[model samples]
Target chain A: MEIMELTALELGREIKKKEVSVREAAQAFLTRIAQTDKVLNSFVTVEEEQVLQRADEVQSALDGGASLGPLAGVPAAVKDNICTEGIKTTCSSRILYNFIPPYSAQAVLQMQKQGAVILGKTNMDEFAMGSTTETSAFGPTKNPWNTEHVPGGSSGGSCVAVAACEAPYALGSDTGGSIRQPSSFCGVTGLKPTYGTVSRYGLIAYGSSLDQIGPIAKDISDCAAILEMIASYDPKDSTSVKRADCDFTAALTDDVKGMRIGIPTDYFGEGLEEEVKQAVLQVAEVLRQKGAVVEEFPLSLVDYAIPAYYVIASAEASSNLARFDGVKYGYRASAYDGLHGMYKKSRSEGFGEEVKRRIMLGSFVLSSGYYDAYYLKALRTKALIRRAFDAAFEKYDVILAPASPGTAPKLGQSLGDPLKMYLGDIYTISANLAGLPGVSVPCRVDQNGLPIGVQMLGNCFMEKKIIRAAYAFEQARGRWQAPPQAQRKFEKETVSASADDMQRKEKEMRSASAKDVWKTEVKTVSASAGKAVD
Target chain B: MANKISDETIEYVGILAKLELSDTEKEQAKSDIERMLDYIDKLNELDTSDVEPLSHVFPVNNVFREDVVTNGDERARLLENAPAAKDGAFQVPKTVE
Candidate 1:
C-alpha cells in the first residue's frame, strides 16, 4: 500500500519494523502535499527544507536504538494558529502575515517529542471567526468530496489535509464547531477534547475559554493515538486541566454493551436535513443492535445554544483579540498621524470583514449599557444549558446527533448570508458551550455523495466513552473509502486553475484603491502571496 | 420581534472596536447587527432568572504557581516580528509631544 494511504499508527508500526524508513515516509507525504495541495488549497505554509531536516533527526534517533513515542515517524500537519518555533503562524489573517513565533505551542512540542515529523501549517478562517474557511485571508479550502463544496471551517484546511491524504493526521482547534463541522463536511474523524484537556499556551486565542487544540485523522484509532500524546498537565496554560494520563488506545474496545446513548430529538427538528437525521438514527440502531441502549430524549436548551455561543464567543474574542494594535507585533498602518490613528487604521486594515464584524458585535454586546441585556444574559443562559447537559448526563453516558445539520454546502453558498452560515453551527456549538468532549465520525454518504457524520458527545473528560462508541460504530461500518475527487493525483488543469486564481487576485489588488472597503482583501491577497513565496 | 440595533449604535460600536466603516459597509453592518440581535433576543423567552451565570464550563478557580521564572526572555526573537522597533523596545507613534 502507498505510505500516504496508511493510518498514522500503521505508518508508525512499519517505520519501527524497518519495513520503511522515517525519511522515506516523510518524502512520500511531502511529495503528495506538493502535488495535491495546490488544487486543495489546504496549506498556508510548507517549508520543504525544514521538513526534511526534522525527518533526519527522527531517523537518527531511531537508528541509535532510542525508543520514540507511539507516533514516531508519522507526518502531521498543524493548523496555522498554533505557534511553531520559527514557523510563520498567521492565523490565516493579514495582521499576523509576517509574524513568526519564537516558541512552539505545547501541542507541537509534545508531538515533536514523540518523533512526529512536521508537515507545513494548514489554512484556517481569519482568527477562526467564520464557519466556512471562505473568510480565510489566503483563500477558501475546497472540500475534497466535491471541489465545488466548502470543507467546513475554521479548521477546514486541517480536515481537508486528512481527507485528501495530504497528511496522515493533522491538528485543528475548535471554538464553536470549527473542527467537528469541517471534519463532518470532509468525511474525516476530528476530536474536540474537553476545553482544558489539552494545553492552549501558544494557540492564537479566539474565545479563549472555548478554544481547544485537537486532532483530525483518518480514523478513530489515529485520533486516540494523537490525543494520548498531546493531552498533558502544563503550567504554561492556567486553564490546563490536571487530569491523569489518559490511556486513549486502551479505551478502544468494541464492547459498548451496556452504554446508554441519548438522542436529543430537538437536534432532528426543523433545520436538520432529512438525510442527515436518518444517517444519525441509523447509527443509533447499529448501537442498539450491539447491546447498547439508545433512547430519544428532549434537550430543551438546544434552541438557545447558538445565541448564547455567539454572544459569549464574540465577547471573549473582542477582549482576547484587542492585543493586535500595531505596537508590539503584527501589521502596522503605513500612514497615520497619531497613536490613536495608528491603532484604528492598523486594526481596520489588518482584520477581514467577518473578523471586524464579530469584533464590533462583541464590543457592542459588552458595551456599558448593553452588557446586562446581551453579554450577561448569554452567560446566564449558558449556565442553564450546562445545567441541562448535567441533568441529561444523569440518564446517559453519551449523546448522539448529527455533527452538522446537513452535508457540505457549495462553495460561496454560505457567504453573504451571515445568519444562514451561523445556523450551520447550531448542532456542534453546544458541545463547546458545555465544555464536553465531542467527536465527529463518518457514518454514511448522502445522495449527493457528500459524507454525513454522526456526533458522539460525552460529559467533560469522558472522551474515552465517546471514543469507544465511535470505534465500535466504525468497526461495524468499516473505513470510509475516499471518492475519486478526493484522491489528489494532480492533473495539469489544476495548476492552470491555481494560476488563474493568482491572476484574478492580482487584478483585484490593482483595481482596489487604498481607501476601498475591500482594502483588507487587497492587502491580504498580496500578503498571502508574500507568505507563499517566502 | 423588531430589530433593536440602530445605525448610531453600529457607528458607536465601530468606534469602540477601532474599525473604520464606509457608508455602504455601515448600512450592511446595521442590518446584520439588527438581525443578529433580534435573533439572540430569543434568549428572553427562556427564564434564566434562577440560574447562576457560568463564566467558564469547567469548575476551575485561581490556578496559582510559584513566583519563579519558568521561561527565559527571547526579546530579540520577539522583536523580529515587530513592524517597528528601536534599539531595545517597540516603536510606536509618539503619544505626547
Candidate 2:
C-alpha cells in the first residue's frame, strides 16, 4: 500500500517499527500534495524544506530511543487561522497575508511536542466568517468528490486536505459549524470538543466565545487520537478548562449497547434533503440494531439558532477583530489622511465582503439604540437555546442529527443568498451555542456521490460518549472509500522522475491554468495501470 | 418589530464599524440588513423576559494568575511583523495634529 493510504496511527506504528522512515512518509505526502493540490487548492502555504528538516529531527529522536506520542512522525496540516511561529498564518485573508506569528498556538505547540511533522498551513474562509470557503481571498476549495462543488468552510481547505489525501490529518477550528460542516461536505470525520476543552490562545479569533480547535481525519479513531494530543488547559486563554479526563482514544470501542440516542425531529424537518435525512436516519437505525435505544425527540428553538448564533458570534467577532487596525502587524494602506483614515482604508481594502458585512451588522446590533433589541435579545435567546440542549441531554446520552441540511451544493450556489447559507447551519449551530461536544462521521453518500455526515452531539465535556457512539456507527458502516481522484496514483513515467525533475514539473503544473491541470490529472489517472484502493 | 433599515442607518453603522463603503455597497448593506432584521424579528415572538443573557457557554469567571511576567520582552521579534516600526514601537499615522 502507498504511504498516503495509511491512517496517521498506522503510519506512526510503521515508523516506530523501523519499516518506514519518517522522511519517506513526509516525502510521500508532500509529493502527493504537489501532484494534487493544484486542482484542489487546499493549501495556503507548504514549506517543503521545513517539513523535511522536522521529519529528520523526529527521525533522529526516534533513533536515539526517544519515545514520542502515538502521532509521532506523522505529517499533519494546520488550518491557516491557527498561528504557527515563523509561519505565515493568514486566516486566508489579504489583511494578514504577510503576518507571521512570533509565537505558536498552544495546540500547535502540543502537536509539535507529540512529534507530529507540520506539512503546511491550509486555506480557510476569510477570518472564518462564511459557510462556503468561497469567501477566502485565496479562492474556494473545490470538493474532492466532485470538482464542481464546494468543500464547505471556513475549514474547507483543512477538510479538503484530508479528503484528497494531501495530508493524513489536520487541525480545524469550529465556530458555528466550520469544522463539522466542511467535514460533512468532504466525507471525513471531525470533532469539535466542548468549548474550553481546547485552548484558543493562538487561534486568530473570529468569535471568541465560540471558537474551539479540533481534528479532521479520515476516521473516528484518528479524530480521537488527534483530540487526545491537542486538548489541554493553558493559562494564556482564560476560557481553557482544566479537565482530568482527556484520554479521548479510550472511547474508541465499538460498543454502544444501552446507549440512549435521540434523533432531533427538528433537524429532519423542512430544509433537509430527502437523501440526507435517510442517510442520517440510517445511522440511528444501525445504532438501534447494535442495542442503542434510539428515539425521535423535539429539540426546541431550532429555528432560532441561526439568528441567535449570527448575532452573538458577530458581536464577539466585531470586538475580537477590532485589533486588526493598520497600527499593528496586518496590512496598511499606502496613503491616507490620518490614523483614522488609515484604519478605515486599510480595513476596507483588506477584509472581504462577507467579513465587512458581518462587521457592519455587528456594529448595528451593538449601536446604542438597537443594543437592547438585537444584541441582548440574541444573548437571551442563546441562554434559552442552551437551556433547551440541557433539557434534551437530561434524557439522551447522544443526539444524532445531520451535520448539514443537504449534501455539498455547487460551488457558487451558496454565496449568492447569504441568508439561505445561514439557514443551512441550523443543524450544527446549536451545539456551538451550548458548548457541547459534537462529532461528524460519514454515514453514506447521496445519489450524486457526495457524502452525507451524521452529527452526534453530547452534553458538555461528554466527548467520550459521542466518540464511542460514532465509532460504533462507523464500524457498522464499514470502511470509508476515498473519492476517485484521491484513489488514483500517478502514471509510471511521472512517478519515476528525478527529484529535481519532479519539482520542476510540479512548479510548471502549479503555474499552468487550473483547467489544463485538471485535464492533465484526468489523463494521468486514466493512463495509470494501478488498481484503485478500496 | 422589524424596523426598516434605512440608508442613514447603514452609513452610520459603517462609520461605527470603521469601514468606508461605497454608495453601491451601502445600498447592498441596507437591503441585506433589512432582510436580516426581518428574519431576526422572529426572536420577538418568544418570551425571554425572565431569561438571563448568556455571554459565554462556560460558567467559569475571574481567571487570575500571578502578576509576575511569564514572557520576557521580545520587542525585536514582535516589531518584525509590524508594517512600520521605529525605536521598538509600532508606528502609525499622525494621531494628533
List the candidate 1 regions with Cα displacement exceeding 4 Å. Answer: A492-496, A503-534
Give the least accurate 10-residue stretch of model 1 chain A, judged by summed lDDT: A510-519
lDDT of 1 by residue, B1-97 (tens): 8876777788799888887788998888888788899999999999878878888887777877679977788888888777766687876655663
Error of 2 at A210 (Å): 0.7
Among residues 3 or more apart in sequence or in different chains, the pairs in candidate 2 whose N, CA or C atoms overlap within 3 Å are none
Q: Candidate 2, residues A1-534: lDDT per residue as tens digits?
A: 778878888888999998999999999999998887766778889999999999999999999988789889999999999999988898988788778899999999999998999999998989998888888877777788887789998899999999988898999999999999999999999999999999999999998888999999999999999999999989889999999999999999999999999998878778789999988888899999999999999988998999998888888888788888866776776655567887898889878899998998898899999999999999999999999999999999999999998999998898889999998888889899999999999988889999999899999999999999999988888889788767874222223223443354345334422223323433454367342211
lDDT of 1 by residue, A1-534 (tens): 888889999999999998998888889988888777767789989888898899999989998988888789889999999999988898988788777899999999999999989988998999998887989877788888887889999999999999999999999999998999999999999999998989999999999879999999989999999999999888889889988848888889898899999999888889889999989999999999999999999988898999999999999998888999977767776666567877888888888989988898899899999999999999999999898999989999999999999999988888788888998899899989899999999998999999999999999989999999999999999977775674548554356767665564345333322233223543464476552211
Instruction: Provide TM-scores for the models.
Output: 0.94, 0.93
Angstrom error of the Cα, residue A49, model 2: value is 0.6
> Going through the candidates in order, what fraction of the true interface contacts does each contain?
0.77, 0.74
Error of 2 at B9 (Å): 2.2
Best by TM-score: 1
